[model samples]
Target chain A: MKRRDFLIGAAATGAFTAAPHIWRKDTSLARASNGEIKVGVLFSLTGTTGIIEESLNKATLLAIEEINDAGGINGMKIVPVVEDPASDPATFAVKARKLVVGDKCVSVFGSYTSASRKAVLPVFEKRDNLYWYPTLYEGRECSKNVIYTGAVPNQQQDEFIPWLVEKFGKKFYLIGSNYIYPKEENNYCKKLLEELGAEVVNEEYVPLGHSEFSSVINKIQSTQPNVIFSTVVGDSVVALHRQYRAAGLDPDKMPMASLTTSENEVAAMGGDAAAGHFTSAPYFMVHQSPENERFVEAYKSRWGGDKVTHFVSEPSYFQIYLFKQAVEQLAASDIDPTTIREAVKGQELIAPQGKVHLEAENLHTWLWPKIAMAKSDGQFEVLRDSKEWLKPEPYAAYPNQHCTADGLVQS
Target chain B: MEFFLQQIMTGLSIGSILLLIALGLAIIYGSMGVINMAHGEFVMLGAYGAWAMNAFFGVGLLPSLIVVFLGVGALGWLVERGVIRFLYRRTLDTILATWGLGVMLQQMIRLSAGGELRYVEMPSVLTGTVGILGVDVPGYRVFIFVFVAALFAVTWYLMFRTTFGTKLRAVVQDRSVASCFGIDADKVYSLTFAYGAGLAGLAGALVAPLKSVSPEMGTTYVVDAFFVVVLGGVQSLFGTVASALMLGELTGGLAYLWNDTIAKALVLLAIIVLIRFRPQGLFVSRIRS
Candidate 1:
């Protein structure tokens, strides 16, 4: 009788532990069958990258609210299950699993850094879920599970490097925050510089969030590079900019051109420090167009009057519209991730940047790249506009590698 | 010769900042033995205080320093009275509890301040570069070196020359005996914690114009501050100053020779080896129990 009691106790404990999972599965099924579609909003609301990721989160939510208010996808309300991974890549993977397998979200929109995206990649692939990634990245990846709405290395650096060499000088100093994104971007920049017979004076990477830049400033001054091409992100951007100015490095003589320093960073670094710097991106807050104006107005009104839009947030805002258009094309009962991805392949939207189209072959967006100089009031002054949208080459640095509809291909 | 001088200048600048950041932790952890893990949050609060003053009331960073210090010090007093006073005897619990408090403080700031990066404007007078020993250094950096020296002197006087410092040191040495001898040990501990937190606030306000002011900014400083305190001997204030400069020069020299990543790894490795040889740290306290 005692042995039987022990067995019963073990069985009860097992059932208790598994109860939450079973309940969650039942709710997921019921919600899917109901007149609502669920998607996960995974963005870091706190931690090191929270400064930028919070804006991205706000942008995603604004898009979702707009869609629902205008009547979401064939009269079906899109339910967003938001989660904060707190800027840790390991946490991102865990949250992705919960969103995919536990909450049963058909799609998720998230990630700011390349590290976070790489961490979550396997989860979506294994679970056959879609992830809408809207950050400009290192661009060597090709995944069917992700819809890439941001610019690739080629779209950003193809015209940016040559223009800098022609206007500034042949000598370039490359500095960035130590990470996959900056290293990869620098590699592409090196390849382009080699083709143009430009000299790389020095290349350096500091740990992320490193605020001390005196040594870096000393190096830049000693080397005297004509153009400092910086890919530093997060708090390091502000530190480097302020330190550079403090070291009396004139941006006019040898301006620091960057791919990552947006209006958000400028606002943090203070406009005076960023006044003469340049940045290359697909969008800027000052980009003049009716679509951009409306989007900016709507964003500020919804978020606050002080909130400003930038490159990453622009893509974050537009990708939801793209998702909505794709969802509109799908049948009411067949809104699975696979069908949604198929429907989204060739979708087009008049985004704040301009008219953008999702490439059917590679699943990356074609975007118009612009180079802008930061003004004293924390706004980008447009200097050069790529009149035509540039196609994304995910493997632009590798001559033989290409991203196709099937997968990454090499010849 | 110029390159070497430039590197030394960079090292001095780095060392000054490290000293400013680590001084507060040395006081809190050295005297109290509370293992206050929320020291970084105190620094964060100070930076936010400066930003708030500038953003809302048009007050500059210099004038806001005193306000931030007092405000953050009061917060420290509350924390001591509310959570830390009870856990004084339990060192491990204090660590855990303070860590949890740190997380709570970070989330609280994020919710209130909206997590976006905020900037502090540098004074116009300190904007230009100054030539020292034929090496051009920022005027602000030179100011930091002088300011930190003055601050350290003041802290040193407060800890050694004052009657309150005498009572605090007596309590730190023997809490029960000091309590029996008419020293209110609780008040000493509370005031000590508040003073340390106030120093951290001052450090944060001073560095606000140099770095980005955000919620997570404190985490970066706290790690380095802990390193300085550990390597310098937790009980020795002079040791903290010595170690900060040594680490600064070592990093600057090694980074100039190679790169930042290898330099950091080597510095950390050196610290580990040194700690293994001298577990009590570089400066051993002669205070008897």
Candidate 2:
């Protein structure tokens, strides 16, 4: 009788521990005569990534407000359930699971880092929901469950590297924070640089959250590479920029270019420090267009004039409006995850950067990359703009991506 | 030769900061027989204090060091008296309790101050470079080196030449006998702990301009400080200094040759191998049993 009681107790404990998993499998997210279309908004609103992601979160809200003001999506109010990942990858996955399984969000949108996106991808894919990742990243890899709204290497590096090689004598010195994105981007750039007969003098990566760059600075002074390609991110950006200037290296003579530097960083590092540096992105605050002007005005008016927007901020704002258009065009009364995902494909919106479209082959957008030079006032002056919207290359190969990628002509 | 010189300079500058961080632990743990795992959180509080003074009161980093020391030091005194006083003589319990206190303090800071990185501007006078022997060394780095030297002197004098230090040493060696001699062992212990905490705050204040101040910043420093303390013979102040210098140089020298990740790994491995040989650390205190 005691043995039987022990077995019963063990079984009860097992059942209790497994309860959360059992609760996670429920997929009753489809709207039935919708009172409100619920969407999950996830962002690192606090922690190390907070300063950068804070603006993006506000941008998401601004877009949602604009949509809700315009008679709501599908004549139903769009309700948002926001969750903070606190800049932790593990926490991002946990909050993502809660957003999808518990909150029953129709679609989840957010993730500033590639690491966080990778963490949350499996959850979204398993749960059969769309994840709109808005951060620009190194090229390659795609998922049906996720949309690549950010600029890829082909759109960003490919355009900028050639321009740099032609303009500056290319004894390239590379530096980045030790992360997958920087490593991958630098490798891709090196491959491209070698193809054009440019020499990569040295490459180095300091750890993320790294404060000091004195050793790297000394090395740079000695080597004196013609072009410096950097991919440093986060709080480290502020330190590196200030230290570089204090070291007395002329930015114009050996100007640095980054895939990650944006208006937000420039402002944070304080104005005039980032002058003469170049950054390539799909959008900048000083973009010349009626759409950009109106978007910038709306952003400043809503968030206050002092709050500056950047590359990731614009994509996040546009993605909400894009999602709304996709859902409204579905023409299905029961707007579930499936209908929303399908409707989003092959949809085009004149974003703040200009016209962006979701080409059906891979769930990536066609974005126009611009190379801008940082001015003293914490703003970018557009140096060069692309001829048209450049399609993303998630799996763009060594050299023949422009000539022959499978999904090139599908649009 | 120039590159080697540069690497050594980098090491020394880095090592000085490590020494500042580890000194507090060495004193408190060495004298009080209590391991304060909340040492890093105390450093974080110091950084926050400096940042607050700079942002709100417009006090410069140089002027705010004293305030940071007193503010964070008072808190540390309270923590030692309130929570740590009971856990004396129980090493395991002290470690556990202090670690728990560290987590609670981290969460409290995160809740109240928010987890975003706070900026502390470097004074314009010290932001430029000073040319030394045909190399441009940052003025701030030079200032830090000088400041660390000054701090080392001050602390050494306090520990070796002062009456409080004699009393603390007496209490640490023989608490019952020191009490019999009318030395108030408890008061000495409390004061020693607060001084250690104040030293940690001074370290943080000095570092505020160089790095982005955040709640989690102390975690990294404390781990490095532990290494310095452990590898230097935790009871010997001079040993802590030597270990910190050696470790920082190894890291900087390796970083010149390899990536920061591999360099850090190599330095850590080197420390482990060294500790394997000398488990009691490089130097041990001589005490009559």
Candidate 3:
């Protein structure tokens, strides 16, 4: 009888240990398992970029909802952990750390400007997590930990410059807000323009928050370049455009091609000012793909019909799918980040713009960009499109230029 | 020789705007001993007010200027009566409170106008360039220089000559004594705050044609204005004007040669050294006995 009692006690202890193991595995699989993945959305919800990012955040939420409704990634429900960076770089870094280390988010997707991205880069690198940054940036950076889903200089400026040259010829006036991205991007363009046998009439910069451009606008008017290549960002774009129009400089006569101005800027520029301007971005409001149509409808339904969609939001939406594809390819109940990272490499996504393929070298994606004419309604009428996806070359291919494919990768 | 003269003219044009803004800050700090952190916001308010008037009424430049001046002045009065009056005796509290108020005002503007810069149309008269010593200077900038100089002359006359100005100055020197002299110190304070704010509004309206009008655009000027106030003895208007012109020339001239960041850093270093030598400022004036 004593022997029987000892055996029963041992069995009870064994069951107690086994029960927790079973429940933990089950809960883990249920919450973040085969049917669950936790991804973080970091955005500047309260900073200078907040007005632009609000639309992006809403679109991101809408995309997640639609994806979940369509049975999620590999039959797993996608969970998004949203964090507000408040537009402060230091705060962005802190939130990025919390999202990666504390929440154990597999990937973080957001950042409007280079400053914010630079702030969050270390966090992703230290944590060895995936970071999908969706903004046009000054290229010359290649990192193993981050995937640049936006336009590189080659993707944006290469085509943009040649197109301007064909339309408006070589003499160009360059204006931009004084900042790293503008300065670097314009510098790249200046090199490219000279390579293409074009002349830079005048290159001017205003302080980032400089509202008055009477001086600059007057300068541009007097210079009378064949075209104005503007790299202005934030509120400055609207001001510059309005001042351009006010100066009686006709767009048709001396056209303005902007790399930074998007549909989001049109609302700020007002219909009268932004109308008839040309903008080049990877995404536009009036893209005629079925996927984009569905995205627009869903976004409108989510954020009201009057809400306008912009370029930044679409890539943010695409990030969720990209993460899901990575998760599905790994196909493990508990995702090992290294495996997920491997899976993310060479992942081809049928995005709203077109098929986007991840470059194995720098982890930047090769996505087709759409050139759109700004309409009065704050929507882009896709004027011209490169239906074929342009492979992203972060460095210039010209022999004269020092930029090389390996230039982006630091030793 | 031409380039040097051109730089001076450019410096002077920029200096005019800086001086107007610094003058407004100087007056409020001189009278109330409060920094009035929302001074920039008042400028923003005036710019927006002018823009709105132009949009709604299609008013000419002069009319829009008048509307902005009066509208922003009323806003100043409201802000003074509703918010600033309560925190006057406590200097640190006034500064902190005004800072909060400034942020709140910027956010409100953002909500109303979105976070984009609005363009204020320069009238036909303000367009084009004027040749100065064989150098082409923007016509609007020259206008700005003349307008600000006239504004200073008017402000100087009013402050040093008028009965109301004497009462305001009396209150600044000693509020209890001014009250004992039946000056109605509270009323004098309110008027002085409103006048300072009105001046800022005028400065904003004037600058709208030259700069983008955005919500947080004011923040960029606040630090520069602070430098101006401290460099010029904060209690003295003439000192404020002189310091603003010197700083503007120093910054603009340096910016022409150096990278903007390096130029700003140099200015900051110079200011630090000056402050070490004369903690009060370049020009110090004793209060009226």
Predicted model with the maximum TM-score: 1
- In model 2, the runs with Cα more than 4 Å from the true position are A1-32, A46-51, A86-91, A94-104, A166-168, A272-275, A300-305, A375-377, A397-411
Interface RMSD of 1: 1.1
Two-chain DockQ for model 1: 0.56
TM-score of each: 0.90, 0.89, 0.82
lDDT values, one for every candidate: 0.90, 0.83, 0.77
Give every collision pair in model 1: none
Summarize candidate 3's per-residue lDDT along B121-184 as a digit string, tens digits. Answer: 6777767667778877767777878888888888888789999889888888878888999999
> What's the lDDT for residue A242 in model 2?
75
- Candidate 3 lDDT over residue span A303-380, tens digit each: 898877777788888877777787887655557556677888788888888788877767778878777778777677
Backbone N/Cα/C clashes per model: 0, 1, 7
lDDT of 3 at B89: 83
Report the candidate with higher lDDT, 2 versus 3: 2
Top model by DockQ, which number?
1
TM-score of 1: 0.90
Q: How do the residues B117-151 of candidate 2 rate in per-residue lDDT, one tens digit apiece?
A: 66677778988888777667788888888887888
Ranking the candidates on lDDT from highest down gives 1, 2, 3
> Model 2 reaches what TM-score against the true structure?
0.89
What's the true lDDT of residue B161 in model 2?
100
